[model samples]
Target: MATYNLNDIVLGVDIGGSHITAAIINLKEKKEIKSTWNRNLINAKGTSHQILQGWASTILQSMESVETKPEKIRIAMPGPMDYETGICLIQDQDKFRSLYSLNIKELLAAEIGYDPADISFHNDAACFLKGELYGGSLYGFDKAIGLTLGTGLGTSYTSSGKAEDADLWNMGFLEGIAEDYISTRWFVKRFYELTGKQVADVKELIDNHAGSTDFYQVFSEFSNNLASFIYQFIQRETPLAAVIGGNIAHADTYFMKETQQELNELLGYSFPVKKSFLGESAILLGAGAST
Candidate 1:
């Protein structure tokens, strides 16, 4: 099949546990194209099955207002999915348990009145890498990795201007991979147990008290673990640099700089750490780029 052309209007959806964010992308522009969204989040609130109906209805309705049928509708969902099979391949229930039991592509296409051939699927972090490379911060970088240190550690690797599935989640990265140590859930749980304080968000912890005893410990430990993997990657794939994104990269003072510093200290090599060029719309934009 011929890839969707630069002139086509592709719709991208960033399906998170909290909300389904959507965008209408004109590939010809390659920058910020038209986009909008609905704010109702169901699955994160334990209404996992309901999210399918909610998203299908909301996305199709929203697409109508764009005045474009979108030659392609590309979606970014949680990891462990089979892109070839066009089905979610879930291994755990941290989120999207209902999707774990559904053939998401068929269900979505049947309900949305679109042919399966008109859609594309990618893990969310892989989508992030595509967005970053094709439209965001790493626009000119030849090779890079996009690491999303969000609720879990979302990771993607890119080379030669294309994206790939490298879901390093809990895969024993360094000591034990992402999600095992350095995620918001993990940090916040450690914070609650260590400080006995009811923190609102994990960013708040890094923002307000990064210098504190607890965050200092976790931050360094996480950085060190990340560095070991970076050093090994240097010995193996050796990409030019790595771009860190998602909610955690906002704490550049905590992880981004430190991650790079550790890379240098541990490996005697230097590489820049870039923040995601696109903001909240990155994953959707990237998914659109993939389509």
Candidate 2:
């Protein structure tokens, strides 16, 4: 077994709709121990035992990759979860329905043989921003906003070293809510409406339709919609900068420039917007730092 400085080591986990990713992070170094990173695909609709076990298994895999046991385990999880009490309140989200109202911290601690106090949960969006604020793109900013664009949209705000969920996903927008027009579902739905074709997600759309006229049109509309939403966000928070992450952000070439330009036109000035420098690692680093 290799010797490690255990005091600085922590297990950081990010639980998404279809997968769980975990790694050992060195808080003193503000980075993940890359060799210990582990990810596992999970069925969100599975029974509670299956989901919890899958998560626990992946976490254990990461923890066991190194000789030292981490000081604590921190998780970046999607909400309507009670972060303080560790109960999941998610329902009607088409994912994790089996976990509704379950106490994840206690259940996961039992699976991993840790005291419940050793485990903690936080909003994934806030964690993402916190990661950026700590050592990524938003590092130097005193106030910033973060957007995670994937299966769903996540928003967070930070100021004076504190980060919290902005909870803007359900905010009212054009026809329904902000997420209805800003997330992966919007890309899939809009692409189908324009071309009568199906795409599993943004990557599929980009892979199958890159450079096509319909592709340009779809992203153009997306740029406008994103700009409109950011306009509202800025009006409310007045953040010094904004950082974006998640799977869909990988295609920033398609929409970022136009979105920035549109937002500038709306606000009558250049606002700082940046792509996430740490990618998925931001969640892990953020979760670990919170510990």
Candidate 3:
């Protein structure tokens, strides 16, 4: 290992079910190198080679935007993956099936130009919470929880400034698991049941029907469902604050207030519920926090 300046750069990659975003970061400054953020859509259902190609292409583009090569690369990868060993087990998840049991670190390093030892991995959900704990909404809190409400539900908890996976997405809820009511599929299903029209995602519905009664009703139900889930989590974990992220959180204005109100009534007091300030780059920064 060689010593470097505090401002030395590292590459951070945030991989999701649909895309991979790569950025160059100045670790000490906690900021991304200007113009170095690059992203590419990945076909989650594609073959292993195609998926790896997408990651390599986007990462190379990000690397090209900077003048110097990075000493390390930290990846925020989605599960089920082995973060410590770098094995990818994304089986039966409708994505990355071909890469099941693959050693991602070795594969990615072979696909790109980095030593396997120079790369590290963390769970995407855990990184999300870690980012908030490191520099985003959960700063200064001794304990916190994070939720990512996207294609699926992601939960994590942090205490003493370190984050870990909570894995509460499958915890028992109403008719099924918490994820059944709190995920993208749930929103789409509920919205279709309410309006008899189908929309691709939560953003589409929010964008197309901002002021409609049905839209408001749909979001109201969403807020309640989310609040109920949060109540369960809070009672169990007892964190100081809860930070919500992911694509559905992009429409915070539509459901946040109601969720807060519901929590207030349920808890008999106000609890801090924050929107993710770092947006898409949170997990990227979190993945590189240890660098």
Q: Which candidate is the best by lDDT?
A: 2
Top TM-score: which candidate number? 2
lDDT of each: 0.71, 0.91, 0.85
Clashing residue pairs in candidate 1 (N, C-alpha, C atoms within 3 angstroms): 173-177
Candidate 3 at 223: error in angstroms? 0.6
lDDT of 2 by residue, 1-291 (tens): 544788878889999887899999888888998888998888888999999999999998887767788868999998889998899998967689999989988999999999999899999999999999989999889899999988778999985679889999889999999989989889999999999999988988988889999999999998999999998999999998999999889999999999999999999999998999999999889888884
Best-to-worst order by TM-score is 2, 3, 1
Candidate 1 lDDT: 0.71
Task: Assess candidate 1 and give its TM-score to the true structure.
Answer: 0.85
Specify the poorest-scoring 10-residue window by lDDT in model 1: 31-40
Query: Which has the higher lDDT value, candidate number 2 or candidate number 3?
Result: 2
What is the Cα root-mean-square deviation between model 2 and the actual structure?
Answer: 1.3
The lDDT of model 2 is 0.91
Give TM per candidate: 0.85, 0.96, 0.92
